[model samples]
Target chain A: MTNAPEITGETDIAPPVSSTGIVAWMRERLFSSPLNIIMTVLCGLLVIATLPPFIEWALIKAVWISPTADACRAARGGACWAFIAEKHRLILFGLYPYDEQWRPLLAALVNIALIVASCMRRFWNIRLLYIWGIGLVLISWLMWGGVLGLSYVENTKWGGLPLTLILATFGVGFAFPFGIVLALGRRSNMPAIKTLCIMYIELIRGVPLISLLFMSSVMLPLFFPEGFSIDKLLRAQIAIIMFAAAYIAEVVRGGLQAIPKGQYEAADALGLSYWKKTGLIILPQALKIVIPPMVSLFIAMFKDTSLVVIIGIFDLMNATKASLTDTAWKGFAVESYIFVSIIYFVFCFSMSKYSQQLEARLATGHKR
Target chain B: MKKVKATAFAVLAMVAAGSVGMAASPALAGATFDAVKARGILQCGVNTALGGFSAPDSKGEWQGIDVDVCRAVAAAMFGDASKVRFSPLTSQARLTALQSGEIDMLSRNTTLTLQRDAAIGLNPTGVTFYDGQGFLVPKKLNVKSAKELGGATVCVQSGSTTELNLADYFRAQKMEFKPVVFEKLEELVAAFFAGRCDVYTSDASQLASGRALQAPNPDDYVILPEIISKEPLGPFVRHGDDQWHDVVRWSLFAMIEAEEYGITSKNVDEMLKSNDPNVKRILGVTPGMGKALGLDDKWAYNIIKLVGNYGESYERNVGSGSKLNLPRGYNAQWSKGGLLYAWPIR
Candidate 1:
């Protein structure tokens, strides 16, 4: 430790800390004030009370595999990981044919790789478009394989993580373009188009998504002409698209309305056509500004995919729920739910991080 | 001229409405049986998860009484038990699923109430299980009968048949009791186990399963002897199709009659050679039974071979052969002092 210089009237000397290590830092930050000390001690007490038992239950005392609940009970009541170890495949794939699970596993991994690759700033190019275009073709081919000598797997057979991804990604992808169209039409001065847009938005937004899904699953089939049938999965996908598009239209409309009048005036002065003015001048600026809210909406919709459990889609949430139906593992819902929650958190957390990065990259006009 | 045009408009509207009505009730002409045959699979709706009724095993294969019922129908139709798709449904979605034609039939544990049969346009094919609402109490409570729980605080799921039955039973017996209501089965079970209530009330099958599967000590909880309501859980189809209804109803009846003739999945082939007329008729050794249901001559034999008799299913699923271990009390065959009586298969 360095010694303090001798005190003199000519210059001021800062006093040396008694302990100049982590101990000193802890003293200043953790116990420097009365409230701080109290909070720290209380938190320490809480950790002492909860942490060891939790660690013991989750790790140390947990059962790895057991044939029955009797075995789980013969050991003391800790986390019955034996249940998870036994049922993890069922939780991950639902009722997908066991032999063909490699297809869905490949489909899910391809989706994740595409998602991760797209999040990279360097991959933000026209080449990215080609990658997605080709990747989707491959994924579709792999998932619904009738060609290439692979056995035909219907869309109804799709379940678990792949189903969740298919629903969210397809729902948001369709909603984005549909929303833009509705927003533009709503802003259009043409009376009939604006009225139609308003009616659609209000109608979809008026009812809960559950009722919308129910109508699609039930009422739409009855309404269909005799001998005509639609797939149940396709019906649910359409309902999600309709519900999300209405909400997204409102968000895009806010972005469009926020575009300054100066941009419109500038485009008009340049003798630009109406399409050019809106596409180049207005939408480019408006879409950039709305990217944050749009990403948030996408995240919200990702969570809303869980609601399809009500309609029996066997998405990740429902598959996890289905896994716990085993009589051997009947009481261990907490562990199963916690496992699925972690999967959700990982996807959502990465999306949030990507949104922040995109915001920073797109901060062009807000230099000051 | 204006009056004539108005009359023409009314006639056109009536024609359109009549066409839609005809389309809706196409099943009235026995279309569902053909539709199911053309589809090459029977669409069966079942509970999301119930221990003795319908639940997915570790292999993601649904195996229980409700699941087997549908498979039996599949066997009767195609002579193969695997030609069925299970649509797992919540309680709220079950009837809507059947009504909307999403499923051809529902073998879920739905109580066959008069209102359900009439208002919801459901035709109860046959009662599969004679379940009843009952109470469960901790061993420490020392309550041997539901009668002693007059002033007890009971935990029950709100807005369910169990909740309504509990209130009705207390009122009918002229007893005073406090009720703790939870909207979820997990919450009610938790509350009861956490000492928040003195008694837990639900269907006896559910209570027995809950205690066996979830209680800290299975021996600590005992279901009360008094059963208050008749659940009469059964499979049902939409109301317009009596032909399809008979197909489903007689499929179950064949199983019951198979048990009466002592023809199990194991011995069904042997029974096909029996000289006894009843067993011969059930095994389709004697012909003419399948034409009425528009099925093959070996329909009963297929169900018996692929699935099992009612007694076998009972023993394998919810009775002594399974974890729930529910007794064959009211569900026993007619000759064995139980209410399960099927019409003669012949």
Candidate 2:
């Protein structure tokens, strides 16, 4: 039995070449059982039935550029992309001065670059924090231009893609540390600190973000002393930070709780201080365990920035909505909404991919 | 722009909303006029998207009747209409934005009502457009009258005055109708277009604007003749700033006055040479009116030059000159047998 098989390299020759490209894989999985085959065939037929007419309606016969709504309504029955072409500027930058739109364009680019940089494995160190901090400062200067010899654009005029990025990036960035503090406090032995953290987290989390935004816009003025005015953007920022912090606290707490007690005990045995024990020994592992959920929370926060429209902050969604008011491009909301959806999807999908890559990279030697 | 809405729902009354301005503001808080002057750009709150009311044009310039009110205020304050920055506010957020000083004035087609003025802390500058709640339905429905509709599903904005008015109208007419309410106007419009509801109810002006702009085929819809609620839509500001309120009120009154005097934008320069004290006062050649309003003597001149009179702004945005082609009806001047009457510019 031991000598039955020859210990030759050629004996391990390529196994039978069973057709194994994507097509074969699809055939094996999608058409494996009768039920699966039937389902796949039905789906294929459905797509076949719907796809061409959809393509014709959405692209081939679509009007790319036209002067008026009637021009779009003429001849070909398809989407009027002319609406988007005419209104794209308003949707991209809101009411920002046409001459100085480059400032917002660059600000949005810088933010996107910073987010991309942060997503890289090499930038996962404290250097990432520095990059983000400096990047945000630069973006702020770019957007609210009273410095660097740039023409001043008031915060009210700052809107569209840049506004959405500012709110989401700042909201998530500010939330991470604030969330960590709340999480640590919730886990602390000190009763007062723990209770305070619990109260804040519960209070903010209990309410919808819309109310927080409303209070910031509406009720906040009543609380302020006369003669002092907080900027509307700043008020909304504070609301977003507070709201996101509460949700992030709950997420971070879950991570902190997952850390084994043995890790803390070991750090304590080594005469480590509480901060060192948590920060060095426990937090790294706990945070690693939670990267997936944390990124999911981040994605959710990014999407939530659209809600600022309710408060009159002309973010991307608001700008898109504002563009639809033009009589020249009325009754073509589907095209506009789809384009906005694609914009949102690109950011979210990248975040998801980055989270997956991070999870793989973090697996390392900590299998236990 | 930041507090959570759940906590907000609990404290709906903004307790000192009305009284705080009346009782506490004059001591030191009436700063909107100064703020507008200092900022150099009057922050005017307008509708996020209302056809013929306030909406951004393709080039990102603000347009429409409500927007003209904002331009008038800016011109009155800064002697330049372009010195205004518009904040596109939602119906729900407009009053809050004004009361909280997020905007110096709201020209967002808001209806003047006792509850709004007293409870929400807004002082109506003046009525800009006399509108009324009405119904819009597909022509195929063959419904000649709003009263004819029984068992029809009516779409109304959830928090809008139209919801209550629709209910009242159907009840008063002894008609059975289902109501479909949506939070966003976009959703409501889409629901109507998709045939989810038989009739869409709003102020009649909006119904016409929606027909001309939002409808796939403008000819497919018909606005019903019945006008239910009296919606005297206008610009407003926080109650505390009487100086700002006066400026807003009179600035609007200036437009009406200009229309009354027949001082068209085209003839404004020629009218400046008129010996009539009325034209002189309106064009600011009389001097005292502007000084009384805490602005330069050229304030009304700037308004006429930059934003045009009530009649011009109306026809350009919502009436004959616009796609809506709506009849002036109640919006016509009192001299023309409509409700628009102006206080004489003495």
Candidate 3:
């Protein structure tokens, strides 16, 4: 070797072009073998086939600012975004009086703000409860508007995104604590308590949500005295709460079962009472283990709010449907639905990403 | 164990007592009327959204022929058309809402039938809109008549009389058809428009609505002339509430009777000076009619003045003035060769 190079301090020649750069990288990762080459070509061909048509339909030929549906119709096969533009107010605020829609808008914003604040670790304290209580009262005031210089709006007039948020937020807020109690009752030493909890959970879980809604909406009125009917929104909210509580209890029980027996024994060895043991030791770990599933359940319930349309409650999905009934702007259901689905996706995806972040952040003792 | 048993017994007793206290009396004739007056607003059940039948307009005001029926009833009862609140009900919940007294009356587009009237404890007030099953086909198909729809694929909404009528029509004709049924109206209409089906069948009014509103080009689809079944859509109330039924019934009849007598919203004040004895009797210029119906002397006048006659409402909502543009063929007055024969106000 000393003889070949004459001890010259020279860099080695660059590697072959086929083994580096984007071309080399593509060759190695995508075209390394015959199967890989075929798969890459096929996938590329699929993208080529679908992407342009979708892009053209969604954007290139889409009508954005047409005053009448005729302009949208003239575009033929393109998306009619002008329908959404025309009906956005109706789809967002529902049958709330048009002049006073600002109230529902304000209420929705207040709710969103509270939800955002609740997500922050800095606000995870008793103060958060106070904030939520105040926020809810304010939301009710804005929606009902019987006092404080605001004109009154009936609850029946409420619809759209505000109604959806109210249903989902209040449903989970009350159900979470109720569910924890139910989970505890199921594991209680008292036979009666355990049996009652089991019966409630099983009965609720056995039936579909639609039947529960039907019972609440259609049958409940028949049971009540004439002229004593409950508010439709309240009845639906109760149904959602009951339905969600049963599922949440089951999920919490799964988390409770996951906790090691050693941990319970350790808590007992520390002279902790039953309540203290649960509150200080068992629940924290159990609930932590269930954050992902809990978030998943929340995401599901958020979407399930759409089912209220069957009972004719004008939540966001129903509002969109009602807007479609406008003969002036019909046949653009695909655009309308796509807009709503994107809204749902944004909220659900945000919840999912936040849960992942939360899991990571709360992974203190469990991390490798 | 003893304490738990005692508590359970107590809870059961309380529930039983509560239900007994709230138990409904066999609905008396004027229960709904009294309840509506006490509540200060007539709670009327209507379709959540069926275009010209019952739907909220852009300003969030309930606008439709069904909604006008409710307003007419309110005007008759309270002398104020605005004194009505609408409960937008799905087709499934409409009857239940009326029966439970949650709604004072149901002006939803419910087709009157023997089963609904006899078995379900409901009574039809009167026919508000006379509809019938019809077919919709694309203009490209050049389908001149529904009879020619042999070996055709038809799109129809499931769990509706529309589906049954489609089957019956095909069976009677001895024609073969592939039915593409969907649970949703939107999906069924989309299937028809997408060329998945050769024809779409539903109520004629709905077909016209779908064509006028939903067709990419309104002129591209045509509703055939053939009607296959009777769909006498009307207002209905609980069977036991006969006085309430009469009030609701006469509210609609007053609108029709007013139209027949040539009384309109614009001419009602001038018609107060009408020389006709029928007009004088109906306008409450004579008092016995109101006393018989247990309403104000000016009840009929209030209805005509506030909500207008049936013809005016029809033309304004679903006829030439609106997007639906449904012809008032069978809905026209009896003297005009249509079937709308209002019973005498007296």
Fraction of reference contacts reproduced per prediction? Answer: 0.43, 0.56, 0.54
What is the RMSD, in Å, between candidate 3 and the native fold over all Cα?
A: 5.3
lDDT of 1: 0.83
**Candidate with maximal DockQ:** 2
For model 2, residues A108-175, the per-residue Cα lDDT tens digits are 99999998897777998999989988887888888878888988888887778888999999898898
**Interface Cα RMSD of candidate 3:** 7.5
Which residue pairs overlap in candidate 1's backbone? Answer: none
For residues A209-244, could you state the per-residue lDDT of candidate 3 as single tens digits?
876887788767765655576999999999999999
Query: TM-score (chain B) for model 3?
Result: 0.89
What tens digits encode model 1's per-residue C-alpha lDDT throughout A1-368? 89888778878656877677898989998999999999999999999999999999888888878877777766675888887787777777777777888888898888888887877878977877887887788889888999998788777667888888888887887888899899898999999999999999999999988878766665565444445568878888888999899989988898888988888999999999989999888988888788788888989998898888777778888888877666556777778887889989998988998988888888997434
The list of candidate 2 runs beyond 4 A from truth reads: A1-19, A365-368, B1-40
Top model by TM-score, which number? 3
lDDT of each: 0.83, 0.83, 0.87
For all the models shown, what interface RMSD does each have?
Answer: 8.0, 4.8, 7.5
lDDT of 3: 0.87
What DockQ does each prediction reach against the true complex?
0.36, 0.43, 0.39
User: Candidate 3's chain A scores what TM-score?
Assistant: 0.92
The DockQ of predicted model 2 stands at 0.43
Docking class of 1: acceptable
What digit string (tens of lDDT, one per residue) describes model 1 on residues B40-146? Answer: 99999998777668877766678889888999999999999999889888776777567556789999999888767775557899989999999999999999999
